[model samples]
Target: MSAATTTEQTLARYYHLHARLYDATRWSFLFGRSDLQARIAALRSPQRILEIGCGTGRNLARLAHCFPAAQLIGLDLSADMLARARTHLRQHRSRVILRQQIYSQPLAPAPGFDLIVLSYCLSMINPGWEQVIRSARQDLMADGLMAVVDFHDTRWPAFRRWMAVNHVRMEGQLLPELQTHFQPLDSAVRRAYGGAWRYLRFIGTPRPIVHR
Candidate 1:
């Protein structure tokens, strides 16, 4: 099997096992999610929003509250995870749509999203994280936002190795790559657990392509 396929299957299986415990367990370490939401709320009143790794839909639920008129889509890869998301987002079920798919390509009908969010997800996608970022740009409107909050890096090799086992790659790479595809409106990197690791929060619009 291709390395990417292996990575996808491994994560699907991992989430299948961890789906039930995700919302409960992720509360402590999934930092800056609510903060990101609040930041987005203050900055934009998007009519349509998409969360790339909506997981158990906790973020989606929050977005629904923050943007009552917004049409929201929660896109995830694992059925088990989306199943949990469905239950978690039951109150806003009518406005929220959930899909199980890898986000390698732009969504059809062209640049439909007003805002696209990547929350603690790009780190887990091994071989194709950059592609996902680029594709999300293609999936966004000319005037659109891309908001991200995710692991930045680790100073401890042991901690890094442990995270790798859990399917996360935190080498402080995502933010720079995101900047390549989007222009920064607001961005920050913060230390986690007394600098043992770091995480980034960013909100940006698509970088204009300069024709030569």
Candidate 2:
């Protein structure tokens, strides 16, 4: 199998057991989720929003409250994760659409989403993170926004390696990639747990596609 496929399988297997405990366990570490939602709500009232790797639909459900009139799509690769998401987001089912898939390419009839979100999942994507970012750009409308909140990097080697064991790579690479594909509207990296690690929040809109 290809490396991307391998990465997908790895994440699937990892979340299989973690999905049940995800919502309860993640609160301590998965910071900035509510803040990111608030930031996005304050900036735009997008008509359509797409969230990549919307694990357990935690953000999606909250987003439903944030933007009551917006259509929401929550895409995740793990069936187990999507299962939890379905149950967690059932109340908003009328407006929330959940899909089980990897975001390797633009969705059909591309450039349709007014807001795209990557929350605390991109860092775990291993070999496919950059491709996912590019694909998200294609799926974004010309005036649409892309919002991300994820691990930036850890200062301690041991902590970094520990996160890697959980399929996360926190080397501060995502921000630069986001800046390259979009025009940054708001971005910041802040320390966490007394400098043990840092996380970032990036909000941007797609840049004009240049042809060589």
Instruction: Give the lDDT of residue 5 in candidate 1.
Output: 90
| Tens-digit per-residue lDDT, 1-212, candidate 2 | 99999999989999998989998999998899888888888889998999999989988989887898999999999999899899888889999999999898899666889999999989999898999898899999999999999999987999989999999999999999999999988899988989999999999999987778
Could you tell me every candidate's TM-score relative to the true structure? Answer: 0.97, 0.98
lDDT of 1 by residue, 8-51 (tens): 99999999999998888888888999899888888889999999
| Global lDDT of each candidate | 0.92, 0.91
List ranges where model 2 is wrong by over 4 Å: none
Q: Report clash pairs, candidate 1.
A: none
What TM-score does candidate 1 get on C-alpha atoms? 0.97
| TM-score of candidate 2 relative to the true fold | 0.98
